[model samples]
Target: MIKNSYIPIPVKVDKIRFETEDKLIKTFDLVFMDKEEEKAFRYYPGQFAELSILGKGESPIGIASSPTESGFLRFTVMKVGVVTTALHNFDEGAIMGVRGPLGNWYPIEEMKGKNVVIVGGGFAFTTLRSLLIYMLDKKNRKNYGEITCIYGARTPGLLCYRDELKEWEKRKDMSLYQCIDWKFGAEGPIEEAAVEGWEPINLKEPSKTKIKKDIKKFTAFVPQLVSAVKPGAKDSYAIVCGPPIMIKFTIPVLTELGFPPERIINSLENRMKCGIGKCGRCNIGPKYVCKDGPVFSLKELEKLPKEY
Candidate 1:
């Protein structure tokens, strides 16, 4: 019986980056305090850790960088509660605590030789970012077939990793498709609809506010853009991470294009009071999400209770 499971290893927050305009989600780059511990760290994408902030308790957040990324571990967090809010408020160099690389990761090995399509929205793009980086690395890029990424946010300001997305768009190895919910004002779909007299024409953009031209090009829902990509399902895998509703709608789109349940994966997260899965409440059936998964194939997930 290991008695020290509750103790957290000390780490120093080396850098802080605010990826979204609202500043609700921030990515913290951390390194272990002990050099040896840093050297020994290992994790895969879609795994998570229990992050501690002393008085604020701890929360489970996904590890956002590929193991190929060295030196530091990165966690992209949203300030949704006490611990996360405290995390966002913490400064660079602040000492913190991390428990593990808990939960399963994406099936990288199984995905080899298969074309891949990644679908993500808002901050849920963290692990997808890791998967993309790993697959796109020059050493590994050849193992896969065609690569396509379809990502979106409510608006340009809501997108994470903006600069990286720009660079990704320019990369010849993978196809990048980024979209906004709706363009706003005169040049937007809403205005286009309004001028056409609002008689049930589809809006290309979701909001009524104006935005820049660079953002206007992606003025479509993620599902819509995904359909437009038409990635073949026969020899491909689709990994999706997004809001529950976004996920619900996106699955059907993938299926419509021939992707099967076994080839579609979801990186899931739940309210975890204990990272070790000892509390038992994160159960979707016999499985404890914290310990058994944070990643599951659509087929595997279907076998579990829909209560999730």
Candidate 2:
């Protein structure tokens, strides 16, 4: 067991809303009840928070909203188990406990003036969203080179932030590509209703659609995607977050595209009992994942055990 020393702060949930059709995932917008606490709160991209629902227990969740937006903080959560399911039902005006804006942040400062490529899948994209917004903010936009995002999901309906993706698509300065694994027509009624307003309707019928079982196909697409975004080597960065399999194949493709090991950033997911280092559950060797990093360069991660 780990020792606990930090005091839990009371935060008022200003709003709670569904981000996906999956009843499991939800977004919470919160503010510290005490104005002083709000003033003191600060965090960088890729950090996480320890949230507790009184008797229900606590879980580590990434701070999904960007720091560029002040006055409040936000978290995107997916209900994978008991505690998360209980948290999903929480709503506006509810009171929850919070412990930290913990963990290492992405090397945003080091990435300045470099082209950025972000690849994400499923809910893991939550933290990546913050990094994307931080780079796109009006004042910071010029500090980074061209931005490209490639996001995928098990299916179209499972994708989060429908409205936000649309906004990203309209930005001329950035490039965004979204893909789904299964063919849409395979679903009966849901497919018909869901496609009513969605764009780039490229998903083929079940019979014609090519199921992407080959890992090589994914690796092959990475360079093509990055080439379309930033054609030259020069200064560039790549950030990837998603299921383990995606990371396994994507890294090689990035290296082939000329991004050095140090230029690639990744976030490791684990059973984080406490968002801060106080909990030993997320320790990776001598480093506490919740403290030293959830985000790290490939070079830094090479030293960790394969357990994560």
Candidate 3:
């Protein structure tokens, strides 16, 4: 673990895997240069880190690999700006910096014995993947009740961790519901309702209407897919991570299904930067997204300013 929040620990890129077909998003696996740092680096799911590149700046990304998976840490990054683009250009074995294991984590202890409903969309599924893998481990599996996941992307190619998603689908221990915004056929992309800008007339009920038939893939927006699956809210906690629009729409569906405000949790990764409270970039009212949380119960968030 890092003793000083400002000093970044040295690490080397062990592996890189492209997640999206656009060649923009990639997952980097890193290992600490010092064996002691590796031993000291203790973290739980939902915490984030600042990946630093000398002379290029740093980017805050959530820790995608769970603690159960040892030896390395994983971060899925989209090459959007200067720092990310530079990191993407570097080859394997390149050295970098990781400044954290910072911020609060998902309520792992609180979630024990309760059913878990994970709802994620687009690239925001990184930390959720960590939480899921942590819970699915043999030692942790019996500690939680039923596990259900609802994940969707704009298209099949946009989804991250495709191979693990496939393996997740095959597991009898949990239920996975995957969807894509539109299904492509010889004609082209089908289903306008699944598109990002399209809003349903009724937020609680997603429109099932489609522009075309004979599309093979499950086609629906993340919120719409949540409504269709309709996981029971009794004795359960709902964790949501996605674009702001998706989270805005999903909360109502989960609430309509009987999840109380406190039972609904959200991860505000977009609000984070610097991975520490010093920057003040991640503050909403008196609380800091970097320090107070990247994870918060819906009830907790409601108590804060509406800035988020």
Candidate 4:
């Protein structure tokens, strides 16, 4: 609903919490500075905001929390660049600048009655988390068929939202699968035995309690992950987010599993300046990655040049 490009609304930080042990990922719970701003602002799943750290400059980050919870907004930021690193240093109750919750959202209506398959790798899972929660909201839950989530990271400790993932796994309406490319050897037998039902046969649990971080070795097992999330021959959709290489291989696997091009959704990563359509940095051919999408159907993706 935030349609204008120039409006700069001041939002006070309600909380800045670390959701992951890795210093890279943090969640900021924010509310509008003037209570009225909250009344006017709303966004759909997969839309994004332009967050400015005052003098440090602005960056576009996805609205990582679902729109179902209305009082506050959240952004799950990974500390990758200068502005983000500075953002990591901020504490609770700080003020930051926020602009449009811009761009077209995922086609939730179109997805009704269709099984949802979500595949996320590394930090890319942040935006996918928003879509997952949106679908899980009470009214929306029944609109879709079975929900399947396939999430992976470089290592066990590197995985974000461990507690949330555990809870999601318990839901009767959803099937959740998580994998770490390498083991850190921290959990040992207990953790190993627990995940056997979800992992592939060739990648069995190790006898030792400690594990190593080896993402390269895990690349071979990606096909198996794809298999676990593949829907039946009909009535399903797949949404994927992750590093470029993971996405590159996963799409082919989904196509082989018979998911049509129009049913496959993906969020692209590119250098974005404006959260709205104004910035040119994130353009892939004629499309603006920020406004036209962070989310795109496979049919639309096929039309774009492979510059992203």
- Please report, as a residue range, the 10-residue window in candidate 3 with the lowest summed lDDT: 208-217
Weakest lDDT window of 10 consecutive positions for candidate 2: 213-222
Ranking by TM-score: 3, 1, 4, 2
Q: Which candidate number would show the highest lDDT if scored against the true structure?
A: 3
lDDT by residue (tens digit), candidate 4, 1-308: 77457656899888887766667788888889887788777888888888887788887888888889888888988888878888888888888888877777888999999888888888778778889999999988999998988788756556677788878867788877676654445443223232323342333422121223221122213444665434563788888888888888788878988989999899886787876666578899999988889899999999999888
lDDT of 3 by residue, 1-308 (tens): 54677888999999998999879999999999999999888999999999999899888899999999999999999999999999999899999999888889999999999999999999899999999999999999999999999898877888899999889978888888777765443245444444443232223445433322222135677887787677899999999999999999899989999999999999996445566787777888888888888899999999988897
Residues 1-308 of candidate 2 have per-residue lDDT tens digits of: 45253656789889888887756788889889989877766888888888878888888888888999887888888887777787787778888877777788888899998888888888888889999999999999999998878887756666778799889978888877765544454643223223323322212322232323221111112323333233334587889888897788678767766788898899987788766667688777777788888998898888877778
Q: What is the TM-score of each candidate against the true structure?
A: 0.89, 0.84, 0.90, 0.86
Model 1, span 67-89: residue lDDT tens:
88887888999889889988988
- Best model per TM-score: 3
**Model 2 steric clash pairs:** none
Cα-based lDDT at residue 181, candidate 4: 57
- Give candidate 1 regions above 4 Å deviation: 1-3, 184-217
Flag regions of model 2 displaced more than 4 Å. 1-5, 185-233
Q: Give the alpha-carbon lDDT of every model.
A: 0.81, 0.74, 0.85, 0.76
